[model samples]
Target: MPMLDAIKRHLWSIALFGIASNVLVLAPTIYLLQVYDRVLPSRSLETLSMLMMFMGIALSMMLAVDLVRHRLLSDLGRQLADRLDRLALAARIDTHARRLSRPELATAQDVAALRAFLSGSGVTAFLDMPWLVVYLGLMFLFHWSLGLIAIVSALLLVGLTLLNDRLTENSVRAYTTRQRETDQMAAQISRNAEIVTVLGMNAAMIDAWSARRCVDLDAQVKAGETSSLNRSIGKALRQVIQAVMMGAGAWLVINQFATGGVMLATTILLGKALAPVEQMLGSWKQFTEVRQAWTRLDALYRSSPERRAVELPRPTGRLTVEALAFSSYSATGPRGRMLLKGIQFVLNPGQLLVIVGASASGKSTLLRLLAGLWEPQAGTVRLDGADIAQWPREALGRFLGYVPQDVELFAGTVAANIARDPNPAAADTGAIVRAAQRAYVHETILGLPNGYETEIGESGETLSGGQRQAIALARALYGDPRLVLLDEPNANLDADGERLLNSALLQLKRDCVTVVVVTHRQSVLSIADRVMLMRNGQVDCFGTREQVEAWVKSRARPAAAPQSGEQRREAAAS
Candidate 1:
């Protein structure tokens, strides 16, 4: 919409340029007429020189005007990219975090495609197309028969173009859809290349990708073949129509119904009239892509409308979750099987709560909800007595820290990864160093080739798992956050790394930073102020660490042999 609005602002000026350019283009036709009809008959060199001089000036002006139009369109495209790039990226991240968008919907690519369309000649073709009538009118002015021929030519070309579109539309859509799927599959395979390689399925993966690629390619070729054939037809038809117009003009001249000048002028006028149509037909594929891109982006933006938020005063580390419930998608509806249910809890400033659970017991889900990365299907998660949703995400993020089960870094310097992930150039070096020290990873970072400036590849693939985890901890600890959420923080840690992590947690506790962690480590459990055990989407047991440990031990022990009825009755009476 913004792009359209920008174009609308410049629409009149662009139209004016098109008008001037088309009128100036008429100079050549006018010159031929003047030379053949006036200069030759009068045998005057003065009139011919004057006409050529005016033609030269008009041609120069036309070039300048067209250049300005092109520049305006190019700048408009750049502005579109500048304005929508961040919004598309933010919407994408928000959608992924909230599980609101289909994975195949790539907003960034759509924006890029739209930009390409605006900057290229696709839009200009449509802009120049409206001037076709002026040229046709001039043809009519020459003679009625010439006008009839030009009209017929235009209609035939327009009809052919529409027919081409009708025949290829379905195949083009199929090709686009199949291409997206193929690209998604390729990205997935690349993301898991290590697993595929280790399993010796490289050939199989290649085969799978090639098969999908071929499907898309086949669809593309199917559409392209029709388009190519139709283009050839259109070109041949134009050529035939041009020859017919010339023959008719000569016949009219022989009969003394039209002059030599009129005959030559009509041909030039017909070309000007049909030029826009030909341009549009030649670039029809790009026009379709542009339309598709705009449609997708429009839909994406409409679905993810921006919201206004009021900044609230910051609060100390206190959290409350009430009647929380979450579910995974199913064949029936959005909320089907509950992953977590009735998960209520509270934490005061400086408190530490550890959650322990078996696989798929909703420990990770609970952590995600607490971190505000997900919305619960029922009830709410409140931080410092206010619903987390009430706070602007960036504002809320400042006071909270999170490290997921699978830690990830970025493709940037170590300093950038540790000191707030975005626009890291503004991140303070001293603060980065301090956070690293707090996480006990300062020495580790220093050992790198560039120390804090070391370039770590995507997801920190250049580093070992333990090193990645250690740096992620440093990132979470960077902002002096009031609440820290970590899941399996020590999963990949060496003994020293584990010791350093424990030390970091203790330091955070000492600093009155409320903490919630999900882990299976006994060492981590030993230091918790309280513990909660989750089982099958419900709280199995929750209490102080010692109490929970006792309950767990009791549950693990075998039950006493069933008592006889009389012994049970006697014990009850006692």
Candidate 2:
């Protein structure tokens, strides 16, 4: 609706063009009348030649106006697409961050569909629909009975169109929902193709995928069948109307209320009046699809959160977390169990803090909160004395680097992956190589056939898991980020990879970059200035490395000591 106001000028121009084109549509009927009533009776070649010249000029003007109308619509559609594409993508990304299910935000495909409808024949039909009255009035000029019949036929076709819409709306909606779910499932299967193939899950996966496909297909078939039936009936009725109009015209002419030329011209005018309605009936499905797409896009745009208008300066490495808490939605709905509660920590610039915890101990949740991937329900995360939400996202991203537990690379060249730049040409080659060197992946990259220019398959499928993690580490270290968060960075690393990771962390520390790493391996703890141990979503210990290690040893001593005299006697016998 607001979008309509934006393109009002374009719509007005199209309306003017429609009026001119429909007026010229009367040229053929006029030509027939002149030929039958004037030229033949008088045997005047001059009159025929003059009429032909005027008709030619009128039709040419009509053609020129129609072309301009189409061009305007196309330009309008392009402008709309350009404006909506970025907003749609942003909304989709925001929805993902909020952990919301909004399949309509998955892509800008809906924008494209709306654009196509705007520029295609569907719009032209809509613009011409209003001119149907003009043709009907022309029919009335010839006789009253013909006008009555034309009005009745038009109403019948309009009723049929309304019926079609009512019958197919629900099925179309269901089909759209099912199709999006199936597409998502298919993408998931493709991403995990290696696991499926190695585990011999091809049959089970295929069966599951096919089940969704079948449901989607069933909905589509139901909608299609209803639309097709209506279209066929509309076509048959349109033919009948044309024939009946001609017969009625002949009756009027025979009764001396009209001329033969009047009868013929009126019948042709009737068809012209109903042509747009017939075309709309046949294109009801496309019209419905475009309407749904527009509705979804509008809803998405309206629901998207307003972004910060003011940009702030980049942050320094000093980090703070105060009573942070967060929860996620469960399968049932909102208000699920909490994942992190009262999480408190602080790390100054140039500090190296290592977090050690068992599996499912809230380590990853803490890292995500620190990295701003998930917002805390309570408390504030601050950097450089400013709340994380206060700083502009782009500025914050430049100062922060995060390597998640599951390392995956996008489809691009090795250099591009390391740079994390969408535009490869704009990527800084020097910085990329420096980051790779720091991550100790430079030599391994050079050993490849094309080195930095080598193409990495989707998610780096062509390379080993260690190779992917190394490049991802390089990405995190790119541009000498002021703050780095690594979650289990050495999960897939070999001995050499582990050494490179530690060396990278050491170099980062020397550069005054604050770092937080989550690891179970004690080897990585050698570089830690402080240690935080977590248990059951709470911090068990937080202090200097020496203090935490001594506590750990003391706790182990009790469990290692003899628990009973029987155990002591067995040991003495041995």
Q: Score every model by TM-score.
A: 0.93, 0.91
List, residue by residue over 92-188, the lDDT tens digit for candidate 1: 6776576564644546667787788777777787888877788888888889999999999999999988988888877887788778778878988
- Residue 528 lDDT in model 2? 90
- The runs of at least 3 residues in candidate 2 whose Cα sits more than 4 Å from the true structure, single-residue gaps closed, are 82-85, 94-99, 104-109, 303-308, 330-334, 551-574
Between which residue pairs do clashes occur in model 2? Answer: none
- Give the number of the best model, judged by lDDT: 2
Q: How does residue 190 of candidate 2 score in lDDT?
A: 91
Instruction: Give Cα distance to truth, residue 141, candidate 2, Å.
Output: 3.0
Clashes of each: 0, 0
Clashes of 1: 0
lDDT of 1: 0.84
lDDT for position 297 in model 2? 71
